[model samples]
Target: MGITHRGTTRRVRAALSAAVVICAVTAAVPAAATAAANATDAVRGPTVAVGGLDVGVERISVATDEGYGAASITPDGRSVVFRSLKDVAGSGGNEVYVHDRSAGRTRTEPIVEGWTPAISGDGRQVAATTPAQGMSTQRIRQHSLDLGILPFGCGRCNEPSLSADGRHLAFGVVDYISHNRRVLVADRDGGYQTIAYLGSGAPARPSISGDGRHVAYQDRAYQKEGVYLWDRTTGTTSGPLEGPDTYASLVQLSDDGGKVVYLSGSDTYVHDVASGTTQRVPDVKGVAIDPTGRHLLYAPHGTGGPSLVLRDLRTGTDKTVSDQPATAEVDSVSADGRDVVFQSAADGIVPGDTNGKPDVFVRRLF
Candidate 1:
């Protein structure tokens, strides 16, 4: 979380812990999609120190270059995918890069400008959104970099998320004028089918379970902008899953799609879809749960900036993974919950983080 000063950028993080958060209702729109247009064409930029940020407790590992952002780890935790302005630099272009932890090598995606990348289950495929020709909207792409085939299929797509197997893609496409949105799902090959439309609900982003059978998203309707789940097999949608009257956003789903982890206000809760039980997480915000719905990675919405916390569902005990002065942007957790990756401007989380910018790091829960 770097804030731009007069001309330079410095790490300054901010977040609010809501004592009571209400739904924005139909007015709740998805966060604006990642902007990838070439904003700087000629001006030269400062050089960033790229490597050697990894040093600390063996469990904590730095995943990308010093200035890299928008990172995601593979299910196996072998590799990481991220976006950075360094690839395009002053030209304002964006470049996607993959870092292989075992090999200590970084490879840039051949694509000209790309952002918002997610990995598949096997750690073999990647799903990202690159700008379309006219650049009105971002299009979805699936591939393995230089190998095999990476196809650019959906145009006007927003925040594309990949299924565990990497076989399916789920994202949003909004109408330019009315801003009406639709959640769409499609196979890797192409041909998208609408999963849910806006009327009773305005979904921000949709996530597919590891099994790729259920789709979960935040329903942003007027009455109650809560969480909703969709079944591809039955072609039906259900939820707002009866817990709090406040707004609910889907944060994590079990591999079996039976348990859902969501945020109702600044508090996190786990909802059992079948048993109709909801467990309020003691105190946390912006959580990510493992596919089993047992392990959770969250940020405490208390005091000042919150540290990333990990909790075990069976034991119900919480451990603070990164207690830093700056605060962390809690991202995604590994399927087994052993690895939790996030972006942070916090120093001492690792050595050599002097770039004064937020970089991605993973904390091994073991």
Candidate 2:
């Protein structure tokens, strides 16, 4: 799913009115060509290099399968886990599957109808969300890759993320009656605890820094929706960086927690916490930053076809790897920061036909 921008409706209205007058004649051009050209020009800003990066689709996998969902890569970039309803055991719901890049093999494991898989920085633990069966509370389970059992659970938890040290885990949970979401934290051993709560509003996606010292999450408070960062050491929340009225989604703290990357107003921005500076990477959506914080991969929005692009932070150069339109957007990035994976469909959604099913695809960065 795409990131939702609160108060973006008004911004869209304003942009549309301005764009119609500015690009009125150019509107007849194809979106791909326009985007490619505009992106090339926009990337020349001082924060990014003008043109020195390369992007290409390394390989394509899983061409046929329906309902392939969330995915995460291990720290070493040698393996990936994703949710799929392939039902090797004939079960109807989704399960987690692991793809070993080194062995050139794929295996499935029943993680109980889970999605949004997150692997520990050391690649020892996997955290995922498992919906409750039939009116029960949902759960966030931390399963040891070696032990093969859930060692902990967080009720009503979803969108699980892990810190680089694997000591702390963050996820979003809602009140049973009020439906307001609050971010929760717990130890890897299964001790349930509340770290930060946002009352009367929904807080869905939560991401922890690679250093385990900072956390960023989406929250709707007052009459506004925004993304906030919390300092674990200071116990204070940073003011909304995307502005109080604008909603920022897919908030990610860099490996060192020094920078934040988020989708705001249909583009990705990198905010430096220490410098209090922001740099926008124009004409891109659905961004993923590498662990080293030197590279960014994003997909362009509103294109009829799927495409993946990458940008080098040191030098603002960008490139598109694939020409075919992607059915789904890029979801999770690998720990080594070399691979980008997402789900794609063969054909548009058709009833009763599973041939155009959504399958997982991974692209290695070269």
Each prediction's RMSD to truth: 14.1, 15.4
**Which 10 consecutive residues of model 2 have the lowest summed lDDT?**
14-23
Best by TM-score: 1
Candidate 1, number of clashes: 0
Give the per-residue lDDT digits (tens) of candidate 1, residues 1-366.
111111121121212121211111111111221122221111111222336333222212233344656666666666667666465644334667655555544555545345467666555566666666674556665555334235444457666666766666677777666667778776644355676666532445677777778777776767646677777666666666534555667776666576777876557888776666678885577556766677777777766754777788779787666777323321366666666666666665655556676666666655
Local distance difference test scores for all models: 0.58, 0.57
TM-score of 2: 0.73
- Those runs of model 2 whose alpha carbons end farther than 4 Å from true positions after fitting are 1-67, 86-92, 151-153, 189-193, 243-245, 304-306, 327-331, 335-337, 346-355
User: Residue-wise lDDT of candidate 2 within 1-366, one digit each (tens)?
Assistant: 112222221110101111100000111223432221111100111122225533333222333435675666655666566776565354334666556555554544446555567766655556667666555467765554334445453357677777765677777877777878877665544343455566654645777887777777766676445666766666566656563336666557766677678777767887777777777887677456767666677777766644766667778776553445543322256643566665555343222324666656565555
Positional deviation of residue 332's Cα in model 1 after best superposition, in angstroms: 2.1
Per-prediction TM-score: 0.74, 0.73
Candidate 1's error at 79, in angstroms?
Answer: 2.3
Model 1 residue 337 lDDT? 68
